[model samples]
Target: MKKILTLVVLSFTLTMNAFAAQKLDVEVNGLVCDFCAQALEKVFGKKESVKEIDVNLTERYVRITLNEGKEIADEEVKKLIIDAGYDVVKINRVEE
Candidate 1:
């Protein structure tokens, strides 16, 4: 009975982790046009870890959804955005 209970708990934990998503909202500065948004999307979209990306020019924020069990470090995010000629104001991570 104890073994069965443990198994059930473990399975539930694994299932939850498998479905977990890592979302990152990066507030940026210096993104001026549609072209800039497209460039940002292309840069982040090339990463296998990134599942989806949304660029909001009005707010100057980039939203990135990471694939299951995948992540990009905060420093790397900052570096990439900077390399693309944008300033990183903040990186907010949401786990779901």
Candidate 2:
């Protein structure tokens, strides 16, 4: 009975953490080609907290999915893009 109880609590905790994960939508300038998208993907994918990255060149947007209990600041996002030779035009937190 104790083992079952512990398992139930652990399951609930994991579920809640998944629900608390963060997502970000960022519009960037100069994301004009597949190579540019690949560069952004490589940058964001290297972060341990980043679970997923999706870039749409047509829409000039980058969507980032972060693990639970982790976050990247707007300034940091801008800096990352800038360092990768792009400019961030807008950033917004995506509600889960």
Candidate 3:
């Protein structure tokens, strides 16, 4: 019984850690120029929890990484990108 309990606790901790390191891939429209990309970066960069950001101009995708145990809502991220003078086509949470 003790062994089983230990395993259960370990499993829960691992699951929570996995969720904490979640990364999201957001695809946006009208990301045609450097200025527009810069704007998007600026908005997300301001977030304290954001760890890294990658922008693909050709694919019009923005990949964002949040610090461990940190996450920004989809709507909030989308709104930030939209406010930067572009349209958020879609936001998807990438699987690890």
On lDDT, the leading prediction is 1
Q: Cα deviation in Å at residue 81, candidate 2?
A: 0.3
lDDT of each: 0.92, 0.91, 0.85
RMSD of each: 1.6, 4.7, 2.3
TM-score of each: 0.87, 0.79, 0.82
Candidate 3's TM-score:
0.82
Q: Which prediction has the highest TM-score against the true structure?
A: 1
lDDT of 2 by residue, 28-75 (tens): 999889999999999998998889999998999999999877878998
Candidate 1 regions exceeding 4 Å error are none
lDDT of 1 by residue, 9-96 (tens): 9999999987799899999999889999988899998999999999999888999999988879999999889998999999999878
Model 2 lDDT-worst window of ten: 13-22
The positional error of residue 19 in candidate 2, measured at the CA in angstroms, is 4.0
Clashes of each: 0, 0, 0
| Candidate 3: Cα lDDT at 68 | 79
Task: Write candidate 3's Cα lDDT for 1-96 as tens digits.
Answer: 999999999999888876776688888888888888788788889998798888999988999988877878998988888788888878888655
lDDT of 2: 0.91
